[model samples]
Target: MAHLFKVDRVRLLCSCGVLKPITAIYFCRHCLKLRCGNCVSHEVDTLFCPNCLENMPSTEARLKKNRCANCFDCPSCCHTLSTRATSIQAPSPEDSNKTVARKVYYLACTSCRWTSRDVGLKDQTVATGGWSEQDNEHYKYLQSLLEHYRSVAQQEKLDRERKRFSHRKSAYLSLTDKYSLPSLLGRKSLTPLSPYAPKGDSSQSLDMTASEATAEVEGLPDEIFTEEVVLSSVTDMEQRMASPEWQPEKTSDLYPLHKHILVKRSLRCRHCEHNLSKPEYNPSSIKFKIQLGAFYHVPEVRMIRQVELKSEVETCVQVSLCNPTPHDMTLAFLPFVPEAYTAMQQKVEEPTDGGSLNTSSMVRVVDIPPEKTDLTPSADVALPQGQVILAARDDTAEYDDQDSISSYKDDPLVVAWRRANKVGINLLVTPKANVSRAKVGFVLRYDYTNTVATASESRTVTLNIPVMVDVGTVSE
Candidate 1:
């Protein structure tokens, strides 16, 4: 209870060897192991603009430097800039005699009340595109650099392809390029290089001027030491760092920045390759496409109440256990001891680079460390020693007055309270002596039924889970 701010007392140890809350962990149905954020792999599902909520393709987002086209952020405040419209009366082009009213737009910040006019930016006749955009001064040189690198990469790829192709006997020169009608009809001819084959771009080179580093450094201003520093007139670090390409040092040079693109990612289990969490592609839709959270799959355990815990002394601790599954469960409690991470502490997923390591060498190599669970128990728990039967979940049973009361008889020492699929149980916790705050742990062995259709036999599988509870020091 009241564990929002402080949850170290009730952290659960994941398979990866990490201690975390159940809400932060995931249960892979295939592996049946607790996965924390560290052990899962994150794959970007969609790129979107957080400001405009517009979905963008990966290629388009890359081309735009992963920034939104329509949305802009205030340079001064770093807040989203809103388009403020003002009505202006102007002479109509078609009817010169008549004065027509039209709306003009300018970027403004609601938080700081900074407007485009403050920075000497002109109001636009049209809202979006009429705003002035700063082009990179070395645009041509940058394009040439890109072309030069692309050609070099292409040539390297071509060389690698040729080397690979020369060794293969299945690959043959194109018939159209090597053989002519005359050769097919009578005369034999030597094969020429195929026209479709990649050739080196001899003309591709950098178009910019070359310069080497010199001993001389650029001189600072003559009045640098004497000049007065005005904080309001200078841009903050955030404003300058907002646009990395042009880090404006002064407020006068500050410009509206394009909003950076946001991405939705899907998490997958590393062991079984099962999707743990997947979000919908639509930016506006908040619902998830597939979310297999540990909270929904595993039995949630929470500390309800605990008696005084003296060092090497017997104490009573009350905890509420809820079965998230829809089927009836035969629950058992157990102690969990946390150990060091061989593969980072459980809950953390191993990162994959989308490539397999070459294992054909003299020694087989693998990146991830082995899993280690050889941890000493911090505390001990006294269990019911037998199976605790819990009935299947009934949604309507909560509202029914007749069914609201539990008919199942419970042992006085074990079951403190029971409602629906949730049961409150009391267990004796004994902590090690001299340890100020010893964490008591238990191993819960339960009978779980595998309902997956691919399973050969739908039978009750015994599952053992380790749980830990924090017990503070008790006075003599």
Candidate 2:
């Protein structure tokens, strides 16, 4: 009589919608799918080293020579061998230190019965142990080698410094010329002065009177001094020479005024053959540091209903500006010129109250239909509009080494919105009169100087506003 046998089973649904019972199915942890070995392809499980297969602790496995100690295989037949321990006589106490003596174990396969004694084996001590003491000695040997190389490097550095100083001294002395003191004194004494005695008074006085008469005649003008003035005075002597037509001639006296002019010629470098004339002293053309800081008063955005649109739309945005500097500043709206517009048109006018003025004539304006005029209900209404996508923000404070004003133009936001969007949208600012309802964004940028140090700062502020448009029915 047999006891009751229970069968374990799993129900699986196939792709064809049929449910079937599965027996002896293997669970695949990798694929998370059950498989009958017949349904999937598989290779035979290969035997691995027992030390590698047993889930022993990692520290114990490292000490075992990375192999299974108990199992040995025949090199010829690949068969497992059995271990056989044999006890041999230990050495006497007097000779124990002289010879390393130990009892050993040997292995042999049952099929071949290959005994260790046949191989001339003996018992020996095994280091079945703690931390190996050999590592300390090896570390000390490496440290000594490192010190030897370090000393050689220091000696080379000193020798290089001495060679550099000697070369500089030799070059300096070769460029200068020096003379002895005795040769210099002999050259100074060679110059002589006149040693003629004065003549008798009457002869001296006659010589002085004749010299005075010659000096007086030389002081007269050329026209008064010449005597051969005649229209037909071209004798044979004058005919052979060029005619002295009264054209202005540059005299030698004028040459003294221009004697200081020095002519410079281009020179080339002897080694590199590069032209040395006007070589750039500062390799980078940057000259000055433009310190930029901005403090902006918050701008106000008001929704105003204009006279031409069909619905309540944003009309005008007002921005107030104050120049907190001692001197007046001319703020330049470089890329924010009013002629650049998307949809609506605009015109700028000066405020008659003398508060702030827009001198430009190109402010944009949107036309509003005259029917729906009320914007009183929706003051803070969320307008279904997409936000203006700005480029990455880069604060100028992070760039301390940039010393030129032109570098500010390369700022991420400035290059993306101002420069790249040049043809897409119109830029408007405050103090612009007759602004339209369709244009949405306005930015104000200016430079201001501090009152104390006169250090100037730059600021840019943007405003997003709503414009009111006239819809045909006031209720809708």
Candidate 3:
């Protein structure tokens, strides 16, 4: 049956119990496990201005409040604001004094046709630095509070260390009692050792003015209702929200807002602390230096069509599998059970005391990813027992299709047809009548050839990947 609605075309089950699209998943080469957005740790790679495309260090970015000093975003349309310069006649200093016209720079939004003059801002001699800056209202108080909390935490840590070994008063009283050595006039330690004193200023006095609340409230001005409101003259809610610190209401109070900086992120697998994706250091480059996405490594499975799907009734669905590697792969669909995964992991981690058994399995695949999770297949999917051979990806074969042909026999039941490295697979899907919607899931176990370098230089390894298929809503 055809899907009744449009959803994620393909949603793969992550090891962390997340059902995400194949594009959003990552394949860790080191661990040989699939990682999702929630499972991996994200770290900012580079901080750059999206408008200017200029990169800065983390310290500089933080000092500038993660914003670009030269770039500004329009308050009204949220577009990049351009610095415009105009030659205006300078005002005469006095009756006898003569003045000359000078070119001054001001911020203007090209999209909304908003000029800095609308906000009563005077033109600046310099294009970037002369703009006025307002200090955060609660910055000082917040810093003081942060310092107080830090000192308190530090003191508590010191107290914990001091009390960790001995909490008794005698241990801290005197060296004579602690060491059980009496002072001798003839010989001994030259002078009695004094208790170590941390020589540093411990406490700092803070003068903070607490905010006071009043019962009396001020009402809105009468002019608000009496005066005619012009939408162009007044700032909108979104415009005010751009600069949340100020949130000025009047157009005259709308100042040039700093453009927020964008960051490049690097993803790492939390379980093994391995890099799953990392971009080049150059901000202008768009390619990744080391990206191990599932799309490039994992066998791509996409739903072609569902023939018949109903409650308790068996159906046939066609799913296409495309091999992305350079070497041929033997694919087999199997039942996705937790116990099966555990058994495989046990075989991978058999205890070895440097015996023959340990030496034999030393060249085998190592990482055993976590398989126990909340995500499970809702529908029953019968897998094919026969091994499906998929040809290796050939770039030149795409042009010369007739010249390149594989000799592997295709199964009429499981494999509908084969084209280059891609294969069309047909599998049996049965939906349980207990639920309202039909969902089918299974596992793809393949004989993968790991080309990664190792001490043993072994290539063949078995891999299991979870597969999920959405069969759409069941019939009444």
lDDT of 1 by residue, 1-476 (tens): 46422556666667766667788888777777787776676667888999889999866886787899989999888899999999889899899999999899999999999888888888899878677678878787767766666655545544544654566443322122111122222111212232255475466444446668899999998877899999998888988888777888889888888989998988777666678888998998889988878777667777776467777887888877788778888887654534433334434344343223211111112224335543455557676666677766777767867546667767878998888888888888777766666576777677666555655665667877666666555544
Provide C-alpha RMSD values for all models, in order: 9.4, 45.1, 11.2
Q: Least lDDT summed over 10 consecutive residues: which range in candidate 2?
A: 252-261
Q: For candidate 3, lDDT tens digit of each residue in 1-476?
A: 24522335556667655567788899876677778776675667888999889999866876687899889887778888888888888766564367778789998999988877887788888877678876779777767776665555444433433453244332211111111112231112321221132522265324445669999899999999999998777888888898888888987788888899998888767556667888997888999988888888888887776455677787787888889888889998877675543443333232222122211101222234545433445568778778999888888877873745558787688887788898998877777867666666678887667767776755677788877667666664
Error of 3 at 276 (Å): 2.0
**lDDT of all the models against the reference?**
0.69, 0.27, 0.69
- lDDT of residue 400 for candidate 3: 72
lDDT digits (tens) for residues 308-413 of candidate 2: 3223443222222233223333232222222232211222221122212212111112112122212222211222122222222234424656433432223332
Query: Which candidate, 1 or 2, would have the higher lDDT against the true structure?
Result: 1
Steric clash count of candidate 2: 28
Model 3 Cα RMSD, 1 decimal: 11.2
